[model samples]
Target: MKYLADVTTIEYNADKCTGCGRCIEVCPHGVFDMNGKKAFITDKDLCMECGACANNCEFEAISVDYGVGCAAAVINSMISGGEPACGCSGDDGGSSSGACC
Candidate 1:
């Protein structure tokens, strides 16, 4: 899914990471790879903006503004005048649509 604004530029706060592999395990796009002990954004552009890494991270080390890079959500927000409600609005929902189902 091509996004208007690539949301793959992930922000990692090393201080917050606990070296947990949950993010790595859950990410469908394989955005993260373990570096020593902590997780790192190995492939930023390849990231689907899926927040699986962020959601699964207990330490809150990973964060991104958009999730899943869904054009539907952006279009919905543009037409509705508010943030889209496709579940992955920001930092509070699953990265996949499967969560909605």
Candidate 2:
């Protein structure tokens, strides 16, 4: 399912990307694709803001505004004026309790 359609906070800098495909390899949501020798964000809306692509990018080409993926968290973040932190534990976007959902 679409996690946050039209609202992904992930940013990709092609100039910084080494085209090593690490982000593509690490992203669990298929949010990126190859664009010649660099990486392209093919589906930004599908992103869960989990930070997996950002953490895995050695060149620091990827950056994500991490968030706890829910409507309450979004409202809370707005009220608190703080960035949301997706509580994903790893590249697989699993919860801390080891659940995918």
Candidate 3:
């Protein structure tokens, strides 16, 4: 399931990257790619602004406009008496993640 990703606010400051590859590890959309020792934004539009990469980066190298998308899902789930999910169907045909959408 693809989220309606528009122009994202995701930004990558390579100078701040510690070469830990944390951003590379957490981006669900493969938005970040390693340029040898540092990471750069390979595709900004691929980002859903889920904040997963930003949340995991201890070095503060990656930044995204958070508190939307998944946050909206959380609020909607609460209002609708449902659970927050990533919308990815598991092998058993169920939601795979309750967080990090």
Candidate 4:
């Protein structure tokens, strides 16, 4: 399902973006589009926090807050009685169990 409107944590830096289209090619949800030579965020909410775009972006133009949005993460958090986290587990040691919401 779609997340809350305008709640996207993805940030795109035009200066850092080389218009290489890597983000466009890697994003499964079509969250990005080509605006001439620049990349644009067409549907930020479509992001599932999978980190695919960020991982594929060599320029590091995309930044996200990183939240738990996967079913495995949610189930693991519930079973562990801990805050669900992005697959990365956060830098703070997974103290907060909030979803991508």
For TM-score, the strongest prediction is: 2
Please say which candidate is ahead in TM-score: 3 or 4: 4
How do the residues 31-95 of candidate 1 rate in per-residue lDDT, one tens digit apiece? 77889987787667776656677777788898876543456666666665665547555675323
Summarize candidate 2's per-residue lDDT along 17-99 as a digit string, tens digits.
Answer: 88999887888889999989999988788888778888889998889877567654455456556554344445654233313
Off by over 4 Å in 2: 71-101
Each model's lDDT comes to: 0.68, 0.74, 0.73, 0.79
List the lowest-lDDT window of 10 residues for candidate 1. 92-101
Candidate 3: tens digits of C-alpha lDDT, residues 1-101: 45555678878888899888888888778888888898888767778878999999999888887644565456556665666554434454343245444
lDDT (tens digit, per residue) of candidate 4 on 25-78: 988889999999999998888987777888889989998766667676677688
lDDT of 3 at 63: 84
Better of 1 and 3 by lDDT: 3
Give me the candidate number with maximum lDDT. Answer: 4
Give candidate 2's error at residue 84 in angstroms. Answer: 5.6
Q: List TM-scores for all candidates, in order.
A: 0.67, 0.68, 0.62, 0.67
How many pairs of residues collide in each model?
1, 3, 0, 2
